[model samples]
Target: MSTILFHEIVYGPVHSRRLGISLGINLLPYDGKLCSFDCIYCECGFNKDFRTNTHLPERENIKAALEDKLQSLRKENAKLDVITFAGNGEPTLHPKFAEIIEDTLFLRNLYYPTVKISVLSNGMHLTKTKVFDALKKVDEPILKLDSAFDATVRIIDRPNSPQYSVSKQVELYKKFNGNFILQTMFLRGEFEGNKIDNTTEKEVSAWLELVREMNPREVMIYTIDRQTPTKQLKKVPLEDLKKIAERVKQLGIKTNVAG
Candidate 1:
């Protein structure tokens, strides 16, 4: 069995393909995971195992701890690349998320001024003004749009609500007007007898159309980099990812692929 990677308040300055060495902040609990979507590719496992009513870190405590950590890293002469808001679940779901962002900004200025702040969000909460405003403060708000079709989204992402529509989600993304980094995970396979293939021509066509409409600043085309909840899921090869990247580049859209 694979042990959960991020079940704590702070994780690694782990090697990240895009963010370089990143210091992770996990606002969620160290045992259970709490997320709006139960993605098949989530490394922390599904929202079922450790998912339940739980307590997240208080905003002030998070700030103090982060400040202390940053100061310690500085003393050790350890280089900090990015302070990422990612871990077990959706970081934005914290009630004081906005205040947390403000505190992070202040601490970054005081200690790691050169470090960038990035949040890996599911884009489910982007429709909220508070979430949007708070995320706007970050250096990069990389939002997820795993698929363009509502049915495919429901199947793959398995969001909390049945009424959730991918089209509406993309529309909310468009409201950002290309201010965000759009992250996509490309793959093909089956999960529980349902055929899952997001790399098909039809799927790619729809995704590209959505991209054209959103006009994002950049797109991160990555694949499964960790263990997943579903065993039957497949990974997209790096060479094929490069081909997709090539097509994205042709559209004059910046893209980075990590397979």
Candidate 2:
């Protein structure tokens, strides 16, 4: 099992295979991963291992740290392609998430106006109007939707919300009016005692139908790239990902593959 975690509030201008020169903004926890979903393929390990209701950084502190980093990057004349709001876990879980978004946008404009701002979220908070509005303000709202089937989602994402449903989330996504990007993780694995594979015809067909409905700007189809907490999982091949991309493109939607 991978116990990978980010240890800072603002870390990295790391090179990303999909999004180049990405600077990461950690809004979860400095010492652990806190997410709404305990995904089997998460590099940050299981959610229960580091679950907590305390030690969340204040909005002022996060803003200060982010501005400090941005100032240094500006001094160095660093080339940053995107400021990604993603770390060990979900970013919107922060209590002051909307405020943080505002602060981040202000800093980005002040220090690097041309650079894009992105948020990598699980989309669980879209029902929260503040979070939804905040997402609408970002340059890239990369929302996750791994499977259209609730049964497969339970095994793959393990969403903490008991009332979570694929149909409900699809409706929430529709509200974005094609401004969002759909991120889906493709993998084959066995968790506990059940076989989990989200590449079947039914899974792809149902997911594509929802994708057509949402009509997002783009679809990111990627496979596991690191060690997962669940040892039984296997990464889907790049060829398969390309195939999925082709199917997605058939709907007149652009697709990007990351693995």
Q: Any residue pairs clashing in model 2, and if so which?
A: none
**TM-score, predicted candidate 1 vs. hidden true structure:** 0.96
Write down the lDDT of every candidate, Cα atoms only: 0.86, 0.91
Task: Write model 2 residue lDDT over 1-259, tens digit each, in one string.
Answer: 7988888888898998777999998887777778989998899999888665658888999999999999999999999999999887899988899999999999999999999999999999998899999999999999999999999999999999999999999999999999999999999979999898899898888889999999999999999998988789998889989998998899999999987
RMSD of each: 1.2, 1.1
Task: Indicate the worst ten consecutive residues by lDDT in candidate 1.
Answer: 1-10
lDDT digits (tens) for residues 1-259 of candidate 1: 2347576576777889878999999888877888899887788888877765667888878888898898899999999899999988888888888888999999999998999999999989877799999888899999998888988887888899776898888888888878999999887778878899898888888888888889888999998877777788888999988888888888889998898
Q: What is the lDDT for 59 in model 2?
A: 95
Candidate 2 lDDT for residue 52? 55
For candidate 2, the 10 contiguous residues with the lowest summed lDDT are: 48-57
lDDT of 2 at 31: 75
